[model samples]
Target: MRAKVTVMLKNGVLDPQGEAVKSALGALGFAGVDAVRQGKVIELDLAETDAAAAEATVRDMCEKLLANTVIESYGVEIL
Candidate 1:
């Protein structure tokens, strides 16, 4: 099984990197972009065959170390 985790800043959180990208886009003449948000994706190859178990394990990983739960939110995809 394969597990993909997406980690992103929670709503209302300040994202300086995203802001910088947005500013650069405007400077590059792509001014239509209203805002930008940055996030990370982690792809994992797992031995667990059960979809439910795999998701649970990945969720645990996110809760424990993959994501900072207080400032970020995570979503898991089983592939």
Candidate 2:
């Protein structure tokens, strides 16, 4: 099965990268983009098929290595 892990900074965390993107968009004449938040997308090809087990494993992976739980939150989706 394939899984996508989306890791995003918690609210109140500064996102300089996102800010840069927003600035560039504004420069390109994009209107109404008041703010932006940056996150990471990770795609994995795993052997797991059980939804609950896969989610748990990915959550563990995020907490252990992929994401900083102190400053970020994660959501996992299976495909």
Candidate 3:
């Protein structure tokens, strides 16, 4: 089974890095740009038998290691 995980900072959190990128964009003459936030995606190939089990495993991995849930949210999709 294949799993794709996306981890991102929750809304309302101050994203200084994103802000910096936005500023850089403005300096480079990118007009009408608002803001930017950075996040990460993780793809996994699991030896698990089924999508349900794979999703559970991926969620566990996210909660345990891949993500910091206190200020972030993650979604898992099995393919």
Candidate 4:
């Protein structure tokens, strides 16, 4: 099984890196971009075969280590 995880800062949290990218884009004359938010994607190859089990395992990983649940949110997609 394959699992994909996306981790992102919760809404209302300040994102300095995202802001820097946005500013840089504007400086580069890409003025249409009003905002930017940066996030991470993790792809994993798993031994688990069942989709439900794989998704559950990945979500547990996110809760335990992959994401800082207090300030970040995560989603899991099993493929």
Best by lDDT: 1
Worst 10 contiguous positions by lDDT, candidate 4: 26-35
- Candidate 1 per-residue lDDT, tens place, 1-79, comes to 9999999999999999899999999999996898899999999999999999999999999999999999999999999
User: What's the true lDDT of residue 13 in model 3?
Assistant: 88
Q: After superposing candidate 2, which stretches have Cα over 4 Å from the reference?
A: none
User: Candidate 4 lDDT (Cα, whole model)?
Assistant: 0.94
* Local error of candidate 3 at residue 76 (angstroms): 0.8
For model 4, state the Cα shift of residue 20 in Å.
Answer: 0.6
What is the C-alpha lDDT profile of model 2 across 10-70, one tens digit per residue? 9999989999999999999999998999899999888998888888898899989999999
Note the Cα lDDT for every prediction shown: 0.97, 0.92, 0.91, 0.94
Report how far residue 32 has shifted in candidate 4, in Å: 1.2
Question: How would you encode candidate 3's per-residue C-alpha lDDT over 23-79 as one tens digit per residue?
Answer: 999999999987799888999988998888788889999999999999989999898
Those runs of model 3 whose alpha carbons end farther than 4 Å from true positions after fitting are: none
- For model 2 the TM-score comes to 0.92
Candidate 1 residue-wise lDDT at 61: 97
- Residue pairs with colliding backbones in model 3 are none
- Measured against the true structure, the TM-scores of the candidates, in listed sequence, are 0.97, 0.92, 0.91, 0.97
User: What RMSD does each model have against the real structure?
Assistant: 0.6, 1.0, 1.1, 0.6
